[model samples]
Target: MKRYKSILTVVAIAILGIAAGAGIKVYSILHTKSADILDAIESSIDSGSAQYAELKEQGRFNILIMGEDDVEGSRRSDTVLFATVDIDDKNMRILSLPRDTRVQIPGHGVQKLNHAFAYGGPDLLKATVEKYLGQPILYYVVIDYNSFPAVVDILGGVEINVEKRMRYVDRAGKLDINIQPGLQTMDGKTALHYVRFRKDALGDIGRVHRQQQFIKALLKKVYDPRILPKIPELTAQMMKLFKTDISPALAIQLAGFAQNELGRERIFFSTLHGQAATVNNLSYWIGDTKAANEFLNAPLEMLISGDVAENRNTNNFAGLSLSYSSAADENGNGKASGTEKKPGQVMKKDELLDLVRSMPESIAVLNGSGKAGLSGEIATRLQKIGIEVVMSANAKHFDYKSSNIVYPINAKPEVVETAKILGKLLDIPSSLIRSNNQAFYPSVIIGHDNQKLMSRIDKLIEISTQ
Candidate 1:
């Protein structure tokens, strides 16, 4: 995905639609944007809302934008953040929730809050979040990571200063990536990695900060005059990659609103304050519920009354739900290695092709419910390696009844072997594996680790360009 900054910059350009007096369409954008609102109040804590809670009462508005990269029916929200823009104050505050933060997930009961989205999509995630913070969500925006590269590319590219020297390799999959610490110009792929890396000690929180910083860098790109001619291309790319309840007319109006009320200097960013804690024997990122409430409800009260403060939200276990499945580690013997493991392996294009060729029969690439793509990227890759690739529209949709990534059941040994190669190469245990067979009722799943690989790849590409 594009750096959050560039994406937001494009979003800001699109917001012009919302700002314009675009009539009902504009109103629809206001209505459909799903904000993660507090669903139920906690009995132990005093009930209140976000910094901008007051703004709502005063006729101001706030909206939450969430991005998820679900492949199958499995839903796992990738980016969750609250965007509070005070029209009156002309101040916008962005508070991001760490995906791994522990919290009470609505309806499904408390677990890692990110699972709320995986189990029920955005609506349930919003409800769970609202309940967590004791506030009402106003609106929402959801999209996938695939849309990211095009969006970033459309804007030319984003500029961000690197903080550290970064490098990693995935040999089995024939993958290697690196990034230098310094002022750097990142294309779509590199920008995507900038926002996705969270493997460091800081965890998700660190990732969120990187996201915010990149937004500033991306905004500079948006404000550049050079991007004006690319408007049509950018809009088209966004439509292809994005699916939102926000109306087309409203989008134009938002663009207008941004041009008028929103300003770079006026925006503020923050997150909820808390530390990881264990609740009911389940590990959770515990915050001073009172302080959390104060931080949230207080600023929100101002926003709704028309005021705005700051923002702020993993684990692996198996046999619980498809949403929480961990990658398989250890040897094929099914032993628990207790080491941090990646869910699947990566293989070189050539290596993967050989594995497929060795299979007894030609396999078909199937969409959910057994559909197929005529000339898809996967098929092209296969063909390059001398394997006959067939696109199957009749491919069974097994694993991802709820999410997006579909994992085949009893995956071909060759596929597993290929992934193992990738796992060994990347140094992360390979837990994810897919097959061309239309069988194996697998759950749809997209691993968080893929984001890391994507970043590593972008870094490598960046170095090559240099």
Candidate 2:
């Protein structure tokens, strides 16, 4: 039997449910004593935007339903779908960002937007996305694969209209997720893969359509009155598996209107229209800037509240570590809750530091003893372009090796390309590289656009360089 890989690590899909945990329970118990938490939250930050509050007080309320792909070990959002709910108007908007969609990477320059997560994790991803949209991302939600099964079980089952016969093998074991392409119900595992399968030649766009379909179905499951009492359990599960800036009180308040808002029939779903293009000799999913700006604004301005608006201007961002779910340690035990068991779990200390020292803020070169003076020559070449260098011996353990750099969850394509160059320079064979990891770069070689894109990724880099 062919060994199965952990599907959770690949898709990072999240299920819709309640958010709760020990922290939540303890807080909730204490909250009964006084209105301290709620009061604090209100005073600390504005939950509702002044504009949104004005509209709601005038009987207009809007909510942006965001679905984030928080795979195990990595909290960075993978798939970002905006669901806009206008309570007073009874309309909704669903916008999907193709994971491969190319966008500005803040300080780095221009690159695939998904890399924002791998480079700096969630904070960078959120910032880059928020800036691109030109609106506040009011409420944020995160969910992962492991918690998905429990959520489906909690709700008895979620009905999904499966598109094709899903016969793929995953770490959850073999999934015979076969169903006709029509109205149908799905259990946890089946539904999970149903929303994640991107085998079609269209690549990530195929995944986008599947995600849109699941959201429509999930809203239906959430609204049925029969699932009302299960809210506490769902919330608890959410706390264990998800994180967001959305506070407990606000979350509860939002739940109150969930059914009425989500039950509407008129919902809009569209992926940003764009064509694949190779700029500076590197591939990118480029779209019309004007169209993207227009498409994102109407809903973003409406649903995103005030606190998030204020955060949009700040440099505060959160960090997340991602590894395969089945990754094992030296003793063959699983690495962590979210890590997958995979061989050659590269030591981040030495290799990561090597890359950092060589490139610092930009790309770098690495050399093993076998390569002799090659590292020096490459370092000299990089120096001509104002890049730095770190020798194998002088390099600290903090340096990431080709593997870790290449497979970083949510990492940018440029970083991956950097790894490929080091690999080729050191004469490392392709077979030695593990392609099954979450962040594998198809090739290690670098292109001029890759470097330019990396430069645009992080705004902080520009400030530091200046």
Candidate 3:
């Protein structure tokens, strides 16, 4: 009970803890020097209206949360979380969508999820997330990290169990982070250092765990009664630190309902099931792109009241294990009247990998093995995923024994994993996967033992559901 699904929300709430409680804590601000913060809270309460009456009449809603750094320009959301809170069941489920996950933006083809934020702000990011999850999100809250250091310092400091020694220096960030491994208390500045230190092998993903740790520590402090009298001071520093659509009226109204109607609520946290892969030599997290609504996103009940129990995920909130249904949709109904698999071998549909879209931007393929038409044959299969083979010519000398990828530039911005995934589909070996930035795409050299790989793909594609 009383769990925070994401550190962004926890920080926003803790920084402005008392304001979130509506005016119930307004009286406690009388003794503090934070009169300015009290004024802002009073103003919000005064300007608020009962817009959540209908939501209260029912019992659940979903929120889309975006968390970003406090930097000035070229801002991209660092965090994207989808939360579903069902007051009726006293349960909350949260799904954290990684910023680097591949998604199809409205005007942009498949790109990193965070690009939506940079391209169109939260609204576009929301739309992109909705498409990925197979649903829509109406509520949102954005946490600004600029004033976060102040909040931690105001509460004296927060404690964290540093898993390992972190030492990273970034002159541009004016960041020189060096914290030893141990259980210790970190001041505001040091706490920022701890959260932003993402130098482990895990990369950005590792930073997520650090953020979670900080939230746990911050939550412990929020629960401490000593912060009660100083709520106004914290709220003052935080009132302008966040952006949300939550009206003061709805916040207070929901607060009362959450405390009374929903007692000892249960909260669940989950993230997308995927792995970090190099796409075109660039790093990205990729997963099954065709996951259905039930498996990928929150149910409609998450954003509205009077939702059916089925949509609340009451029986299936244990974790992120997803089971596929060949014939059923999220509502336990057929996908469509004529959508069932036709009972036949659909010709021209025999491919192990479906090219997501026929993107023709910056991808290439070549035949390093001199067998005539070998390059064209492989390009056909690659096209299924919507990849138009940019270069399908033979290598300078066609005396190679295997196929591999090459990146002419540094691997930092190359799409490396695309070749690996294609290799799996094409039954290419990992040893054949090279990382020389010599070619734009992968070079496929036909080997004498390539027949076995084709047989495997043929078997997979020929299998019929009917």
Question: How many steric clashes between backbone atoms does each model show?
Answer: 114, 45, 25
Error of 3 at 80 (Å): 1.9
**lDDT tens digits by residue: candidate 2, 45-90:** 4546653453434223222333445555454445765444443333
Off by over 4 Å in 1: 1-56, 70-74, 168-177, 278-283, 288-466
- Model 2 spans > 4 angstroms off: 1-76, 83-92, 167-183, 260-262, 280-283, 292-466
| lDDT: the better of candidates 2 and 3 | 3
Model with the higher lDDT, candidate 1 or 2: 1
Q: What is the C-alpha local distance difference test score of each model?
A: 0.47, 0.43, 0.53
TM-score of 2: 0.48
> What's each prediction's TM-score?
0.52, 0.48, 0.52
Model 3 backbone overlap count: 25
Cand. 3 Cα-lDDT: 0.53
Would you list the rank order by lDDT, best first? 3, 1, 2
Q: Candidate 1: what lDDT?
A: 0.47
